[model samples]
Target chain A: MRIRRNLAGWMVIALVLVTMPALSAQSGKVTILGTWGGHELAAFEKVLEPFEAATGIDVQFTGTRDLPAVLTTRVAAGNPPDMAALPNPGQMLELAAGGHLVDLSQILDMDQLREDFAPVWLEMGSYDGKLVAIVLSADLKSLVWYNPKEFAARGYQVPTTWDELLALTEQIARDGHTAWSIGLESGAASGWPGTDWIEDIMLRTAGPEVYDQWVNHDIPWTHPAVRRAFEIFGEIARNPRYVYGGTTAVLSTNFGDAVNPLFTDPPRAFLHRQASFITSFITENNPGVVAGEDYDFFPLPAIDPQWGVPALGAADLIGVFRDTPETRALIRYLVTPGAQAIWVSELGKLSANRRVTPNAYPDELTRKMAQTLVEAEVFRFDGSDLMPPAVGSGAFWEGVLMYVGGEDLDTVLEFIEAAADDAYTSGAATD
Target chain B: MEREGASPLVHLVIILTCLVWILPTLGLLVSSVRPAHDVAATGWWTVLRNPFDLTQYTLQNYREVLGAAGMGRAFVNSLIITIPATLLTIGIAAFAAFAFAWFQFPGRDALFLVVVGLLVVPLQMTLIPILRLYSRLGLAGTFVGIWLAHVGYGLPFAIYLLRNFFGSLPADLFESAFIDGASPLTAFFRLALPLSVPALASLGIFQFLWVWNDLLVGLIYLGGSPSVAPLTVRLSTLVGSYGQSWHLLTAAAFVSMAVPMAVFFALQRYFVRGILAGAVKG
Candidate 1:
């Protein structure tokens, strides 16, 4: 009889243990998968602290560099997280098309989101006319970083037009210093910075309409507009006097280390074209460097006065995989200016929400960058990210390397065109 | 047999090879202690110029990785996954190898061929199907699930390796044991396993390191739940998505390397013998 009583006690404990996770999950918990870690992740946790305190909902964040692969596998295994932060719109669209993502318009307060964000962000985050993702942070790419002190000492004026920029480049070259430090190397993703150059130049030379057509492959790679952009980029990248260490150096230098030449005791290059995030790297590598004072940026000058300085940038978008009340609450909270201010201040990333004013940024340079993004005359997402992976990350990236490595322009264009043909056709067939 | 001494030229070549192999690890060790700015600013070899300046080094990277990155929990998870996975593979592989080597069973040769053939199957192809099955069985994201997956994936090579060693054993000892009224089980336990320590020890090290270093299997099965994540998974996430915070990766890499290095050194004697065991015959 005593043994029977003991067995009953053990059964109760076993039953409770088995049901514990389900019980906790039911109360208030949401799992978020993202590609952030270290400092960025810590900042995100801070962003969540207030929401967690107010609602008493537990937030679990899992960080992985391979988010797409992990998310795909989880979805296949029928165990996806409540939400996931997608690095690009491509994967978000793929997931949305698969009916794996919840329609954010249904869960989120659309009226508030419309007020918080610009229409461009909403449109970028939509698929099939339904809001599927919300961009959390953006990084401006069309900027030239130069040392303010060096520029002042050299009597170099920030160029605002393409002609003046060319004349300035000539003057800098004549001054016996390299005009630009263009680093094209990023392991396995080498040649991406080159792609950025082409994209930025494309926006300027061909205007936004043709740039869209180029990204969508409505126009062939051999089109005059595309070639013009590449040639304009080559004028700076290929010239031995224009780039620090010349073409070989441009191809060899790691993007992060490329800017080092500009910070040296005797600067090797006077200009570096990179995204806003380069500031963090600058401060990290060169200790005691102050933003705005030591270094500052101006928009990459207007090539066609009609187009103006269009912003080319990338953003991290969050999509809800499971539409629970907790997830809805979290999404609603994430869009608030208060939450966005904390995130931008902590991580030094620009917030997409227009309501997040410039003061939310930690420094004046970042404030200017945020303003540059918000007040741009025109804006477009990074062209490579919008293209199919086969052409975008694959052929387009390789073409940049080949072109800079002295491959003929015709051959490079044709090479990318062939891949785009195959990729776009198959991409359409699947859709 | 007396071995001739290596000539000076051969010695130089061997020394060069050792340097080439050790340089990267040496660089990693040096960089892990240096400040983040210093690491990014100059090559790790620059420290050799000012080796006496202790001010350049800091334990901040190590503290951040272990404390904030949650590598401390991951270190324990790696051990938990590796120890049981290694033992289970050895245990099961030893029994099967003994059966193939000694017992008279129908389809023994064909079954052995099938098990051996499994080695040619790539691990990636089975992840999805097995994961689907695991989720249905409520084993996904559990330590036991990963252990079983490791065992299953590890068994093909483990069994083949052990079978060859078991087959190479002197037949007289096993025959005499069986004739003295020893059961097949007794022979396996008392004779075969006892004689196969070198092979088993070597296999243990291989399995341990393989499971410890594995990221794909762990990521797929465990799904990066911090509670069950191994060191590899945690280490991969140490850097930002665009590979920022890479200085932390240097420290985290060494933290993960510490255990495998220790395991390899401890079983090193057996490892050398095990590699030579099947290669030579009297």
Candidate 2:
């Protein structure tokens, strides 16, 4: 019954995504499938408008997460959309390996792309040493959101180190206020925010190299570093004084709603850790609150301090399924600063291309986020998103939820380890 | 009326069952008017906390849904797909059922058994092959494509239902019609067709609703072409993969549900009689 409340919210989202069709009415057409909706889709249309005008190529955008499934079905039926923007690299690699994707290297100028994109950004879209997709948009996940005006009222200082963050939590509790407003409930994606926490903690506590090892399952889940990451999350998540409505609320509150308390009058809670997308949700839900005045974010503090600051985030990579002169022209335009400037300026999204000037981002905070991505010595993609779905989206998500639900840390890790072993060993990741 | 002593208990049970069935629909009706955030933050029951406050209500959701482009066309498209599919399935299946029921022929029982066996074949297993066939025949994304799919899928049960109903008719009626200088066709038209209205009505209702509500068949065959997609295909786009904005879904769902609810209520009596007809004999 409790879960149904959250499900109702998601059901509305699933039901309401039906929108306008971007049908191409002219010659030189490219059909692209993606999963964007509402504001995001509006912004994307703005991005494509300029490209369409410049190239005189009509781009038809069909939005759905059903891309892979639909693509598979259509391919079996001997039909597929021209290109698709995948949520992760796994599917891109799947299509590429299956020979369903056109190799970008053969048509586009790779040296130019390599010069424009960060090595990691380039790496995200590559499979079997060949570039299969191009990373277009990225969002930073390393920030912990809080209201700066409230921080000023409380005489709190931003913490750059892990010890100071812990002390601030104690100080907030001592002031008779909750320090954190943690909510992981997101319907089919309920435990994802919790997964982000574990990933961030892993990045901070065990360093990026070990984080990679853990994500790839080269190291077992029972390893000390992974366990320590989960335990460190427990310090805030498991503690009743640190969190707003206790552990049950963490399980019950929608992650979008998690930061709502931080915006209330006098502020009910002081902190929420979420990706860049949470900013829109914050402003959309509580219209009166100003970003820098009512809320601002600082990167999650360094755990070991010896490890340079880390940012965990995800990106959308586009892969072409049908090759044509028009499709090739679209791909070439996408990797440029001019094309991305239209999207970044409109949507407050950061570009993976280094060629895009910092000023292209809409706001001061976004400019700073793009700067953080540029300066960070260690950055990792969301760990769970990188692993096979059976473990990453599946067991790892459930593992974190179970741990937050007061299950034994060892038992939860062991459960995740069991899934990871099967998922990795069976080569589901490759598939 | 039959159980006089248990009437109070029966009434109590009936009331409870009605409450169970009606509450979700009531909640949906209440939610359709409330602001998206208000609906998300508080349960629909919270409106009853005051039950009198009208301050938070709005018709914004409905205005947006009805005013959207192609919604009117989508409603028209659903009718075009559904009406033909329903009528064709019923017309074709009625003949096949009549033949299986009245005529004595070679492998007649085996043929009836074969039709019965078709019910076990899942719709999903046949989709790809059917789509391939449709594509080769140049029928995909056409109204005929979806109509043919719905009819094919709706047939096994339709034939089974009509055959059972047809077999239950009296042997003497057909014999008397035959003795009176009636050909088999004349006998079928005169005796069988008019008497099977209840059965036909029920089958019509079932096939109509099934075809109307289907999303997979419409999406696959029609392939997002505006010229032929039904309401579900249009309504599905209201949601992106992330389920970003869902308030529209509640309104769209109610909009689509209205026609079917009307159809059901109009045809309910016949449907009940048809389902009950010859059920006891089996």
Return the top candidate by DockQ: 1
lDDT of 1 by residue, A347-399 (tens): 78899997888889999888889889888988999989888888889899999
A-chain TM-score of every model? 0.91, 0.91
Clashing pairs in 1: none
Q: What lDDT score is found at residue A343 in candidate 2?
A: 79
Top model number, lDDT: 1
* Ten contiguous residues with the weakest lDDT in model 2 chain A: A15-24
Residue-level lDDT tens digits of model 2 in A45-89: 788887888888877666655565665676677666688888777
TM-score of each: 0.94, 0.89
Q: Score the docking of each candidate (DockQ).
A: 0.44, 0.24
